[model samples]
Target chain A: MNSVAQTFSTAALQRNPAWAQLLGLCPLLAVSSTLINAIGLALASTFVVIGSNVCISALRRIIPDAARLPCFVLIIATFTTMTTLVLEAFAYTLYIKIALFVQIIVTNCMILGRAEVFASKQNITATFFDALGTACGFTLALVSLGVVREILAYGTLLAGAHTLFGPTANNWTIQLMDQGLLPLAAYAPGAFLVAGLLFACVRTLRSFKKIPPPKSQSLIQD
Target chain B: MADLALLLIGALLVNNFVLAQFLGLCPFMGITKGYDTALATGIATTFVLSFSALCAHLLYHGILAPLGLEYLRIILFIVVIAGVVQLVKYYLQATSPVLHQLLGIYLPLITSNCAVLGVALLAINANLNTLETLIFSLGASGGFTGVMVLFGAIREVIDHDDVPAAFRGTPLALVTAGLMSLAFMGFQGLAG
Candidate 1:
């Protein structure tokens, strides 16, 4: 949002896709139990988003106007298959941990949303940046949840570093608490609590800076 | 009867769609801004999600798996959902203009909803027979409706309350959902 270019606001970027925009929450709380899992999911999702957006943007003109939505799904499925194949082949360890959610990425509105909104209209370069920005926003949210879950659940940061960063990061974990305390914080309700706290931290920072929060807009009427 | 009852209660309360399973969140946050629309959207989504789950299950297990086209399930499911949404739209246009108006853009958005796919995936994961999958999908959708309506109603009440500044919107909803999740957790041991 700070660039000389004004593509999209960071606030717009960082609005909770799960908690705020309500776009992709299934994996947000579910796969976030560990940093490595969350990071792997984020990478796979980002790859799909970017690949789909770019293809949709490039093909917008040549595609029959009527088949736009169907074409977009085909594009997304192709990219998803590509990402899925790579995950299944090389990163089977992380892949197994996240396979279902990886496939679920095909269902994420965030990907189809850009396909419908930006990529369907804009050029590839702009769509590329847009996906990167949105994925960064999503990654920011994922990593926050990951940090909270890893700390509360496992008493350490990067507790399963080998799964994500490979053996090189086996030394990166930092244990901050003793074992077997605050068991509830490691569970589902805890995911909700940590997400709430993270939202508060962002809101507090936004308020102190005096930025206006985006008010709810009703696009459809009953 | 007992197993069916357990599945119904487990989905409807213990594993309430919004708070615990985290399904259909877009509608949960969007429709909750008002009471009536939330109720309408919830009902509409329940109809679509339940049906989509059924179709996805039939296609996934009955056709795709048999042909070893499981890799194509996502696209196939989306295709089925899109077709279903259009059919529903046409049917609504023919019969209930008021309800059609109420559904608005959300009808097509249903195809993109993760809940439908989540239900589909859960159906395939459990590898349930047709009867069980239908019951589970319907139960999950029904539970989704119940939770969306409840959350929307509670959120309407919370919106008027004097919440702290930092806890104003999504944060507060999430916290309320967390508490609701805790409440739902109470239903855990009841089913088994």
Candidate 2:
């Protein structure tokens, strides 16, 4: 497997920053109550991660060893501020709802982790793919968690689509059920529960592939 | 006084930094393996949270606000928090080598703990006065420590119990935290 495929796999499943490494749980669980909010925050984070990766990888040669962490943080925080300001301008309402978590992305270890572990060591092209893959993984976790929480809590999908989309998209909210859904699914505790289930499911699935039982057992017996 | 009391209660119970708002969860989950470790992490976090709250309040009002650098608050607040963590680490190293050894890597890791920065930003956002911010930080950290110790104890107990196949480690910890959060939900209507 080439570096691109390796990085992509790492981001998507094998070492997904959200699930496998559990780097950015705060933002992962905080703003994922609704699909729109999830998309909004995910996009912002993707932008910051990609931007920071590019910057850090490009400047890797120049950044001193002692000052590496601070430099990486400065670059990440700059992109975070840029994303925050842009979102505040265009997606004002969504920005307000997620303002706290959005700004907190500066502290999201995923981006910094990518910077230190992958980007700073790799070339520009390789780093780009790594960043993209990692961002997609993060987005995957966010949207899935958001979908589950939104469906369970509000009995709807795209309930706040208008926040991200324009006025024309205001009617995009899809009602799934009338009532009887657990409201706890939309809150922080629910995020933990859903996240735990998701992690277990993934782990179980991975475990199945790890053992080709008949072939391995026969070989061992022989 | 009543408002301050309400603020304390709100931070502690209603809007808990971890179970409810999801702030500082990295440490809440990562360092909570044992009771003593969790207590150390929680107290270290509380110190950073409270100290950063005071510093952020002062900086936001005195320097950043005066310079109209509100947009720079995130970057500046993070820098401040990181600086405070370093200072605290150094202070511990100088005065309490045993404590420093106990904390180990967690001391520096506090800079990345969202609770410290979250508390600072939350206090600034709430526009709390200095005293109010201190009280709020106290409550928030107290709540954080309380939950950490609680979760630690539960996890230690669960380690001895017979658990299912897939949900042995982190998944179990999270599910336990979920149930604890549900129990904490009972405190919802107590505030306000």
Candidate 3:
């Protein structure tokens, strides 16, 4: 388990491209209510999935296979328009509340499903540790669903960390509850009821562990 | 007519495209479990999201806003919504060979559905004109095929109500699409 701590524990815990391959759940439930807009669109989709998985694994040999999925979607739409012009020049009000989910992160099928399953065909340092373990498992499911929907809708937790840290991180707001919060965990049906109770609390903590399940998974953690 | 009935009741119930702009939730919770393949994957994602919003409003105002190439309009609206989902899967495999065999491979994954590139980048960022971008892409694909056939007929009656063992399947289909997005937030202000 060495490949750089198996690329940060296979991106913040075994293959969690947003809780185990539910790939970018629409910008992980739209700008995750806030925890500085889910760590500024999870650090601009972990810098466009590790700069389009090391430039599609150093242009995986003259990219032919019938123009490889439109050249890995034009190198993940030119790093999602260079991460939406560097989040509209340094987090301009959390880039206007996540500029259309940062230009729909060029249709985030988890950055073209890690540029068609592990950067075209791995190399450039195992396609930069499978794009830094699938962008640290999609920034640990957008910072743990933006810290449980900003601590159940604005009870507060890094309430607006100086809109992505600037102006001396303006008193980094963490005022956890002065009242019984739960304003539907801040709308859109409380980000689908806190992403279905955070995938039923990671399928009841991976059913108390005794491992083994794997194989073509998806009961989404069940 | 009252601004196309307030842009077709603001895209069939105030800004809906899958419960208030979460835009095409990976084919609204993966081809909404059953109900005739969720009404044939919501009528093949309402004909590739209103024909990629009338060809991304005539190729972003008659060719990428007069060749400024508006930052190559998200790589030319994902190569013309993957060539209009391969011309609606060879025009539904030559005129409905049983809905091209019940939309296999969810009709070319509706060209990577971010709700068909969020209704062609919200009809070219709502500058909209050509008949209000084809009535806001036929009212956002008739409100995404009326909430994917009302969340596929309430996920076929919650797949015979049982649901335990760590809230079976995608946590009971994302808590029944968060109670049908809180009954579509009571159609908020019913289009003002």
Candidate 4:
């Protein structure tokens, strides 16, 4: 039991997919243009990343060295196709906006990177935990950015929640601007600027914690 | 002639491959520190992008889309782009190792560059015929090249110029890109 917890924490502490590693920024920023779009993307990517990790890890040994890239391509394509079909059948409206971006999840650096880096190297159980850790990290970032963009751009949070969460979520909207803040920062430029600023903040905080290495022993040696 | 001009302006300024569309950000930020390097990279990208567009279009229209092979695009494109990069690598090694190294990484990276994939996808999405797809890709690649070189030059100056502490490097480049996107917005009035 302790080992299982240890494994999960190791992924949490040591293998954060979004912040510490900076993987998967494409869909992270692209679909983040709206709250519903962001939620839809987060759910889709989480599904792909977790599913692919498990499948790929299961077949890790069987995959040939010479044909690995193509093999990975084939695997990711199947998963993407499955997700696209599922979304099309049930969530047609949200799926339309996401369009190619959902299929493009196969090309996402973080998802592919994790499959290649961690999942291939670890057992299936550990791989699943690692993928979950990363997906949760990514979902956190996407939700935070979505909240900011939705509030600013539409003067409400979860402005189109019904699109993803269904008709019941029609009441999900939170009016952040009943008083006056229309034309919120939901445009393409705003997304880029916000993402850029977020990246800078993280970089700054990282450098602040960075300890300067001790003086070289060569200089100290007689 | 008017269409060409529209293509040029739209690609070079408006709808920049890097900033506006969010395509090709990997190399845009990675290789734009120096104008000289950026120019070389831009030239190489322009060549590959133009040809990739041409080839990918042919495969899409003449072959894939008709035969119910549209699902095969992502794989087919990677295959063609990788093949082109390999052929270019062979030519460069025999002739100019310096040029090969100059574009060594970005050339291969172009295979998976979302911009390339986005271009092929756009060509199909725009539903252009054979010739139209060719023309569009040429324009798109040209625009990609133009903006790449221009952004590269602007970044060079920014690197030397006094920049704010908070917005020193990537932050400053992105802010510059945002301003440039606004500049490009001025040209959106042109006919496609």
Candidate 5:
């Protein structure tokens, strides 16, 4: 029980998939221009990561070492496909906007990294908690970026909530300003700049107190 | 001919895979510390991307679409890409052992690069024919290589500059990339 709790905290804070590990930046940076889109992608990725982690952990004993990567990728791809179908069915508008990124989640090093580094060796219970923590950490990163970018780009929060939440959410959007303060924040270049500044902020906060070295170096690698 | 040239230039500059479209960022940030290694990875990636795009186009239109197995594309495309990377590895091993050694880990790492898959998927999504798919992949990979080399050069210079502790490595690199991306955005008018 204690070990499980520790694994959850470590994955969530010390080794966040997006901010620290930098495993899944493709989707992280691409779809974060709007809060709703970010939330949608976050939910889909969480489902895939946790689903793949649990499945991989349960089948670890049988998967061959030489073929483990293909196996892990296959599992991740299956879950990603399921996610695609689910989104297309329930939130067709949102699905079309992020279809490419959603499909490429299979190649996301974050999911594959967890499978190779933690899931393949740990028991199912521990793997579940680890996946939960990583998913939460990833969600936090995505939502924060989403909030920042959305406010800067559109001057609105949850601008298109109706796409994800159906007709009822048509009014969920909160207009923060008459016009976006920085229209550049909606463009491709803005993503890199905002992400760079965010990283610097995180570093500044961490510098005040010493933290242990990351348990693994660069989880973005396959 | 003019349309093809436009597509090429558009993919190369206006819609660059890394700077503009945000694909293949893992390698963009990871393997870009040195110019030589970055160029090698870019070349290998270009080779894999063009070939895989060709293969994916054929497989999708020839097999999957005909059989109504389009939903299986994500899985199939990834598997095919992994196989293509392996084939590239062996071909390089037999032909150019020195180059193979230079790109040791990054060669296999290409299997997971989203840009390769992104090109393939984007080709199908845009309904490009075989020739167009090939051209687009080449252009996209070309853009990828160019930006990588440029970023590599920038990082080399950045290493010598005085930098604060909080923004030394990735943060600093990202800011440089943002500036580069801003520069690339200038080409937007050239394409359209």
Candidate 6:
């Protein structure tokens, strides 16, 4: 039980897939322009990560070491497809906006990295907690970036929640300003800048506390 | 001809896969420390990207769409891409040892590069024909290589500069990329 709790917190805060490890930046940067899109993608990715992690953990013993990567890709792709179809059927509007990014989640490296590093070796119970924690960390990153970008670009929070939550959320938008302070925050350039600054801020804060960096294994080999 | 030319130019500049569209960022950030390796990886990526895009287009149009198996695209495209990367690896190993040594390490990495899959899916989504898909893939990958080479050159310069501890490695690189992206945004009107 203690180990499970440790795994959860470690994945969520210490070794965050986004900020610290830099596992899945493609979707992180692309779909984070709006709060609705970010939430939509985050939910979809969370579903994929947990689904694939559990399945891979359950079947890890049977999967051949030589063919593990192909097997992992297949499982991730299946869950990604399921997420794509479900979103298309229910949230067609939001789905259209982020369809490409959603489909490419199979290649996000974060999911595949977890499968290769954690799920393939651990049992289903540990894998489940790890997946959950990683998903939460990814969600935190995406939502924070979404909130920051949405506020800077559109001057509103949850501006289009209706697309995800249906007609009731039409008024969920909270207008923070009459006009967006920095329209550039809505585009690709703004994504890199904001993400860079965010990383720098986190590093600065960590340095202030003089916390030694965690010895987390990097998911990507470069 | 005019439209294809416009598509090429648009993809190469206005909708660059790396700087502007935010695809293939893993490799964009990962293997960009040295100029020689970066350029080699870019060239290798360009080759695999165009090949996989062509194969994906044919597979989708010839097989999946006809059979109403379009929903299987995400799975099929990835599998096909992985296969293509393997084929390229072997063909390189057998044919030109020198070229293989230069690019072999990067070939496998291309299988997971989102930009390759992005081009395939984007072409299918835009309903481009075979020729257009080929051209678009070339343009997109060309843009990828161009930006990668440029970023690599810039990184070489950045290494000597006195960057702060908090922003030394990836953060600094990202800021440089943001500046490059800003510069690329100026090409927006050129395509329009």
Off by over 4 Å in 2: A211-222
Q: How high is the DockQ of candidate 5?
A: 0.70
TM-score of every candidate relative to the true structure: 0.89, 0.94, 0.36, 0.85, 0.97, 0.97
Write down the worst ten-residue block by lDDT for model 6 chain A: A213-222
Candidate 2's docking class is medium
Model 6 gets an lDDT of 0.92
Clashing pairs in 3: none
In the range A1-222, model 6's lDDT, one tens digit per residue, is 999999998888787888878878999999999989999999999999999999999999999998899999999999999999999999999999999999999998889988999999999999999999999999999999999999999899998898999999989999999989899999999999998988898889878877667666645342
Arrange candidates by lDDT, highest first: which order?
6, 5, 2, 3, 1, 4
Each model's TM-score for chain A is: 0.86, 0.90, 0.36, 0.84, 0.95, 0.95
lDDT of 1 by residue, A1-222 (tens): 345134544423544344346567777877787888889988998899889999989989998987787788878978887888888887788888777788778878777777876789998878887777777777778888887778777787777777767778879878788862556666678878888888888888867877666554432222
Kindly report which residue stretches of model 5 are placed more than 4 angstroms away from their true locations once superposed. Answer: A215-222
Candidate 6's DockQ: 0.71
What is the C-alpha lDDT profile of model 5 across B1-192, one tens digit per residue?
998999999999999999888899999998899898789899999999999999999999999999999999999899889999989889989998988887767888898899999999999999999999999999999999999999988898897789898889889988899899999999988875
Residues A124-202 of candidate 4 have per-residue lDDT tens digits of: 9888888887778788778877877677677777777888889999998888687424352565566667766765665
The residue-level lDDT of candidate 1 at A37 comes to 86
Tens-digit lDDT track of model 5 for A1-222: 898899998898888888887788889889999999999999999999999999999999999998998999999999999999999999999999999999999999989999999999999999999999999999999999999999998899999999999999999999999988888888899999999999898878767756554765654343
Name the candidate, 2 or 6, with the larger lDDT value.
6
Clash pairs for candidate 5: none
TM-score of 4: 0.85
- What TM-score describes the B chain of model 6? 0.98
Over the stretch A134-183, how does candidate 3's per-residue lDDT look in tens digits?
Answer: 78778777888888888887777887688788878898887878742787
Off by over 4 Å in 6: A209-211, A214-222
Highest-DockQ candidate:
6
Q: Write the per-residue lDDT of candidate 2 for residues A91-192, one digit (tens) a residue.
A: 999999999999899988888878877888988888888899999989988998898888888899998788898798989989989952989888777888
